[model samples]
Target: MNTDSTRRWLALGALAVAMLTIGLDVTVLTVALPTLAVDLHANTAALQWFSSAYTLALAAMMLPAGALGDRYGRKKFLLAALLLFGVASLACAFATSAGQLVAARVVLGIAAAAMMPLSMAVLPSLFPEPAARQRALTIWITSTAIGLPLGPIVGGWLLRNFWWGSVFLINVPMVIIGALAVLALVPESRSAQRFRVDVAGVVLSALGMLGLTYGFIRFGEYGWGNGLAWVAVAAGVLLLGAFVLWQRRTAHPLVDLGLFQSTGFRWGTALSIVVNFAMFGMFFTVPQYFQAVLGVDALGSGLRLLPLIGGLIIGSRVVDKALPKLGTRAMLAIGFALLAGALALGALTTVDSGYGYTALWTTVLGAGMGLAMPTAMGLAMGELTAERSGSGSALIQALRQAGGTIGVAVLGTVLATQYRSELGTLNRDPISDGVNAGVSVAHQLGDSAMLHQVQTAFVGGMAAMLWVCAALCAAAAVLAAVLIRAPRAAVGEQQERLDDAPHVGQGADASESTHVS
Candidate 1:
């Protein structure tokens, strides 16, 4: 490879490292939740906040982060985000209470919001060739996936041998390395024209997302009888509706509503939500099942998740080869089919089901997500121009984050409700509240019958949640079948247009160097 080519690929490596740290932060807490409950005296609500806080902040800030990067420079903003993430992780590692940890997670989320979208948006600028960009994107997506499995393994080991806080500390070194590499290698890029940041849109989007996410999370804790939950949901829906109207009317909107005109972008975004909803929802339950029900240690639970990770990695590798032949619609249909099938299989799991049963279904779930997510994301991003890449990428990612947040909230509510209902006359005041609490209570009481009841109820709840996911996946499959389009066949023509397109900040050399494929 030429020197210029080598530098670009190296730049991609830096971006991937940064992406991995954020991704690892997402699921790392799943395995650590039990440990947190024991050490920090975290209740069910606190546990939910640990994950939801980060995702909610991420979803809320993504639009602003992307716009900032577009208005300023992607590299500089990314560097600052990395620094903030490192510091926040340090704070999280040393948190004394559940509230402190949740607060730190919010800071980490804000920092990550800046990093995630900007790193992705910078890709088209770095690897202007379509083929190179595809390869880079695959690596980028794979780096994020690598963290999902690694989070369990690493967090498991840390929780087993060290303190629960080690999980957050692990991110520090990764952040430092990512920052240095990015500073040395990645090129700066941004829109030449300064677009006014829509402060009203940002406020509306953030409040709407926070309201909806907090409402569902609260519903899981307090049930639907709580009027506050419904009020928040209703207010969120109204605010989001207002946000859409405002964006449509604004002269310089935070998001380019016109991007939805592309059929690929529309369905791709919808499918992305479906994939994350199922994926995140499943991740929420698996650790609890392994630790609380099966009596496994953290490390053992992490190892049990290996098959799912393996399937994800293998599926990501296979999609590129399959996409050309299968076309977008066919690949998406097959992917969602696997997803629905996997979730249906998961729903059949019993309290006494072995690890092999869980592994089989989770592996299938992973494969389905691995295939669907990247393909849909590629389609959504494929037609976006370089100038609008930051806002565009942020929109895609923001919705995906929102989907994950809502997934956790909705599925958690389902699980909690079903578990309580299945308990049937059992005293569940504080001891038998959630799966973890019920398990702890049964162990303390030394009642094998009570233990059995708790496990059975928890399993029933899990099964109910999986069934809901399966139904959603089935719907996503139908949508993908009807809406997703094939890859655009005219690569050469697209490249020619890109070359001729006016670039304000960059020179002719920058445009000339960029190849469409």
Candidate 2:
């Protein structure tokens, strides 16, 4: 390759490394949750917050973050974000309390919000050719996927040898390397067209998501009878409705309402959200099931996730070859069908089901995600013009993040509620805190019956949650088959069409234009 080509690919690699950190943060904490519950004295609600806080913040700030990067400079904002991410990771590692760690995660999310959109926005500047841009986009996305499987393994090793905090500490070196690489390799780029920041929209979206997530978490902790939880839910719904109205009327909307007019964009985004909802819910519960119920250590639990990752890799490869022939509608239906079947099988898991059984369903689950996620993303992204790519990507990402956040909150609540009900007046206060806590207490008191009860309760709750996910995927399968129309042209042709459109940030060199892919 030529020197310029080598430099561009290297720049893409830097962005990929940065993207890897954000992806790692999504799942690394799952394996550590059991340990956190023990060491930090966290209840189930607190555990939910540990994940939700980050995602909620990401969803809330992503649109604004994209605008900021456009107004300032993508490279400058991205560098600032990386630095902040490193500092937040350190804070998370050294946190003395669960609340402190949650606070730090919010900061990490804010930094990640800036990093995610801005990194993609800089892509066109590095690779101006359509084919090269497509290749770069694939590399960027694959980096994020690669982090999912690595998260458990890396986090497991850290927690096994070091401490619960080491999982967060691991991000430090990666952030440093990514930041330095980005500074050296990536060029600064910004849009020429200035836009107003939507302050009210940001506040409404943030508060609405927080209210909804907190309401579900509260319901999980205190049950459906809590009037406060109901109030929060109601208020959140109202706020979100207001947000949609504001988006339609505002001259400078955070999200472009016009994108939803395309059938591909709408269904593609919806299917992606469905997949994320199921995926996040599974991630939330399975690690706990491995450690608390099956009596595996963190390292063992992490290793167990390898089968799922393997399946995901295989599925993505298969879909990549098959998508051109089969079309998106058929692929999506097949993907969601696999998802439903696998999750249904998982729902039947018993305490004595063994690792082989868990491995079987999880592999299938990962394959389903592999098939659905990429196809869905491509379908949505194909609809964007070069001019709207940055904001459009932000909107899609924010919605997916929000969906995952809601999934954790709702599915976690489902598990907690069912577990508490199954416990049935057996010193419910301590036991209902969490399965891990209950198991620990039972062992300390040498109560075999209580241990059995806690394990059984947790399994029951997990099954219920999986059943809900299975039903959703089944519905999505039917919908995908019926609702998603075949594209008139191939993805390559769509990309060519996008290239034919007027580029944003005109009169700038390839290294300095703000035209996103």
Screening candidate 2 with a backbone cut-off below 3 angstroms (N, C-alpha, C), the clashing residue pairs are none
RMSD of each: 3.7, 4.2
lDDT of 1 by residue, 1-517 (tens): 9998888888888888888887788778887888899899999789988987887788778888998887788888999999999999999999999999999999999999999998998888887766567667777887887788678888878887899889999999989988998888888888765667888988988888778777776776677788998998899889989999999898767777777776766777888888887887788788889998889977787788888888888778788677666666777888889999999999999987888899999899888977887777776777567776788889988888767766777798888888889998775676457888888888999999988888899899999999999999999888888765444442343354356544537533322311122
lDDT of 2 at 459: 89
* Candidate 2 lDDT by residue in tens digits, 1-517: 9988898898899889989888888879987998899888888778988987886677667877876676667789889999999999999999988899899999998999888888877787677664466456656766776687679889888877898889999888989988898899887766555667688887887777667766765765566789998998888889989988998898767666777887878887898899987787778788889999888876777788888888787877777677777877888898899999999999999888988999999999988987887778777766665544567778778778767756776788899888888887664667778898899999999999888898989989999999999999999999988887753344565566566644656543322322222
The Cα error of candidate 1 at residue 328, in Å, is 1.5
Candidate 2 root-mean-square deviation in Å = 4.2
Error of 1 at 50 (Å): 4.3
Question: To one decimal, what is the Cα RMSD in angstroms of model 1 from the true structure?
Answer: 3.7
- Best lDDT among the predictions, by candidate number: 1
Q: What global local distance difference test value does model 1 have?
A: 0.81
Per-model C-alpha lDDT, please?
A: 0.81, 0.80
- Among the numbered candidates, top TM-score falls to 1
